[model samples]
Target: MKKRYFIWFLTGFLMLNCSCNDWLDVNPRTEMKEEDMYQSEKGFKNVMNGIYIQLASKDLYGKNTSYYFPDLLAGYWYKTNNSTENYIMSYLYSNSYVENVIKTIWSKYYTVIAHINDLLENLDKTDVHFTNGNKELLYGEAYGLRAFLHLDVLRLFGPVPVGASDGTNAIPYVTELTRDPSKLVSVTYGEVKRMILEDLDRAEKYLAADPFMLGSMYDLNNPGGNGVNYTPDDDWHYYRQTHFNIYAVDATRARFYQWIGDKTQAEIYAKKVVGVKNTDETDKFVLATNSSYTSSEKGALVMASEHVFAVNCSDLQDIINGVMITSSSSRPKLYLQNAWISSVYENPESDNRSKGGRYFQTDGSYAYYLKYYESGTIAATDMVPLIRLAEMYLILIENSTLTEAREYFEIFRQARGMDFAISIGDETARKNQVEKEYRKDFWGEGQMFYYYKRQNKTSWSIPQSVTIPENGFVIPKPKGQSAFE
Candidate 1:
């Protein structure tokens, strides 16, 4: 087990850049011992921020997992126009390019997991005192992130549906800093599910105690009775939306329950997020408006308010310019299937999602996502959204009765400038409608593939008459990991 874990550690070291001069940098693991790194509260904060920085890298949410790769697999993009692009669209696991992509994803995620484990293991021993609830906040973020990363890994690399009785091997849910190879064994899909729920449960407990969730009295800027006079620099509470706050944890619960086929539990959690009663908690997330996308500023995007958890990525523009199909450049464009666009955005003029949601080239031959659009002025704090309230509504609709589902769906549709009087015929029609909305809403955000997998859809249409294979449902465990075999 020690050797197995060590192999992963080495792989992470080789694949990940241990040093960056930017704010995201974590001193190379060699320079700072684990004990020294956690000796101060500032050190703990650095590790937490570093994990987000790494997560925002091109390898994970920044590209492969969200914006670029999975969008193609989900049938959102048109057929490939080049060999390298073909590797992704075709789900070509045997291709060396695809192999390296999968390996990087596996190693990088475990790398973050390892760092998180180190934090959890050493947190109790820290000599640093955390006043103003910093300790709880740090721990809450750590646990929530651990669950978040592991769940995404399971979604991407673990078995589909995650309730398989065939005893298919799933990714290991590493919860400790293991030097012992014997402890590095992988868990089954069901076991991982339980472990994730356990982590989220702990996260909820800790995050519920967070100052940011305590009400207006705890607002960092207001500092009400606390009298801390907390500035933005001193107040980590200022950016609760960026971290996995309590609501985000609840939203995650909704997602987890939906994944495991527990509709009752899923709907309960989703309602907590949607805040059907219009409680203070739900005010944290507001639906995006037309100006949200059309405006040039960072927070202008209406979906920005809807984000429950996001990672700040200063280099987002560079990533978009390089890969996306912007009007200015088409070197490595990602084209949308026209049929899909028409199916989802039937009433383009009234649909805010179509009229001012994601941008398209003037020729209308391809559409480019503006979800991550940020200007030079706002570049300092650009974020990649991970969880949001819209997803909660989707989860509720997915598991509800036709009438109930349509009610939830109409709320979302009307918010996006569509008619609220729309109706669905039956359960099948409702399901299809729910799916179309997901494809429309989460186009570039990277939820489509997982959505398909969760539904256990055997086949789907992409452009150029291509059909995703059954084997394509699960990315094979990276080569040479006999444990995954």
Candidate 2:
């Protein structure tokens, strides 16, 4: 594990340069003893930040797990017939190209896990180095990240949750810091979910003092009645949204519960997040208002205010320029067919989330996803949104009684600039309404695929609906060493 994971290191000068917003931006390099490095507070921070940096790599959330590959899997992109993208849209796991992509995703996922394990193992010993409750923040972020990654892996590679038995072999829930391959073992899907929740339990406990919980009091500019004056000591604690803060943990719990066919538990966690308020009783995280997305600066394309947790990708502009954007030439892009875009956002002229809206840029026949749009003047624009406030409302819509579902969704709908209330006749109608919101709201976020999988849909819209095969929803684990591997 040590050999494979990025060796986290920071020079004295490098530590001098880190600021509140960019503390997590430093890359790992050089060889140093764990004892020597962990003796300082910055060293621990660099390691935690390094894990996030690696997660933003192309093999992970930076591309494959974010908007690119997963969206293709969900049939969001317009694929030419017989192209590799088309093959993926067809769920052709056995195709050589698709298989290799799967292998890379699997290997990279575990490699990052190895990095996380290293941090978790060394945390307890270095407790003395942290101050101002930073130690607990590190522990909380680490545990929450572990749960987040493992849950995503399970969602992609584990069995479809609709009818699968809990005791079936899912994937290895790796917690060990050891490099010895024999020590790892695969657990049942049920066990995996149990372990994920347990890690989240630790994360929530440790993050009780997280700055995000402080509401308006956490602002350095405001300082508030807590009697805590702003100082350099608080730098690392300021950017709570970019870290896996307390609300993010609850949001993850809500997501995981919904996945496991536990609607009651899902609603409980989702509601907890929905009810959160700040010192002044304002929403800690609110859904994006019309002006939030329509601002001339274009900084809030990813809906910055709503992000419960997001990764700040420093090279986000490079991704936008190189991979996602549309060009004059015929090279395929992450293009949303114009018709499909119109289909999803029924009120394209009125809905703020639509084609002529702030979220997309139309060229000829298709549109470019602008969630990760290039707007670097504001630092918040660089975020790769993972979890946000809107999903909590969507979760409630799925799990709550019909009247409650309508009420929750109406708030969400209004937030997205949709006027008029939905008249959902029954649970099925309510869910169908929720699906439309997910399709429009989560575009380019890599969530639509999971939403379809969780519903265990027999057929899905590749824009034009088609039947999904028995094994289509599951991506095969690499031609592996073992289930444990």
Candidate 3:
């Protein structure tokens, strides 16, 4: 029997808008062989762009990983009238609804990883010439994306790290394009960690010449920036932040290092991202100012300025509408409790991410997180933030000296409109304050659950007092997988 592969055929590939090179304007296309797909630079670009579109699908970051499932597990939303939300937020992983969600996440994530592996395999062996550093850009993005996807998989499915010797079995680190079942097997946590870091190292090396590192010509917020329009002559590297550019590489490194308790490496990479500068020495990625929270015309909700890596989800408005808004109140849906809103942002009047602020909308009984809502006025606002500059600062606060931590903390505080600062008395005080910040910072982004899991928190009190299960953090791998799956 002929063996089937996981690679999507070029006939099923995304149709390109050759008129302007805008990736978001994809349509259906005709068939081409795998060889023909990679015979030119545009083919490679299409494949890469297809992978991103897949990532932004509802099955992945666009809904589950970015906000819905993860945040529910983190206890961000109340179990309003939705039974599935109730089960997930309560950590009833064995429930059929929650189980289906887990199964889908596992299946979709690996499918995307397989596609990435196929792209890398073809990219390295092909003799096609790439112009203006596009080759390096593509290579870096592939490697970085592989690492990024695997790391998130590990975080979601792997055991919580205790130390270097925590030899528990973790998810498979798939690096090859094969449909063979025997090739897929779980490895130790340490092994997966090592593989992820190795890929990141390669990504960093290849991305060294990334346009983001070279100059600010691709700056999205700048007038006449390449992101403004994708002309036929324009290089595809203008929206560096939307891709896994070098700073994203560093930010991911910081996040992974922090996950493994490697404070030294974590701080090193965190500071690197924090220190990013433009050609004129202006801060390349800085904390969001108060205007970012108050400006209703812009995407004040998502805070694009601080985003290190964000996904341009074409379905963002749809996701927001499905989860947070509607014309009729007859449907039971996902929403935050009034208590959660008040508890997390205790000083609601002062904090821009609080109840009275633009980050949430109230209906007298419940609050809706507005971070993912689209403004329609700015094209840049329609995104799901995967990583942000504020998180880099939080990591520094977690790993830096008390004085240094306080400085970063104060800066972040002022940016969020807190405008208050106090000296930390000791390590314990610093740790407590950082935890509070985490609760306030990552409301709908799906990171609060990871924070709780990382800290091994057993009990929480935001919406109400509840004890987390010991195995709650370890999401079970879907069972009955065939070789192809």
Off by over 4 Å in 2: 1-32, 81-83, 217-233, 296-299, 355-357, 375-380, 481-485
Candidate 2 lands at a TM-score of 0.88
Clashing pairs in 3: 11-31
What TM-score does structure 3 among the candidates reach? 0.90
**Candidate 1 residues 52-81, lDDT tens each?**
777877888777788777787776666665
Better candidate number, 1 or 3, judged by TM-score: 3
lDDT of each: 0.70, 0.75, 0.75
lDDT tens digits, residue span 95-196, model 2: 988887787788777777776787788786555557799888988998999999999999999999998788988887888666566755668988998899
Q: How close is candidate 1 to the true structure, as a TM-score?
A: 0.87
lDDT of 3: 0.75
RMSD of each: 4.4, 4.6, 4.1
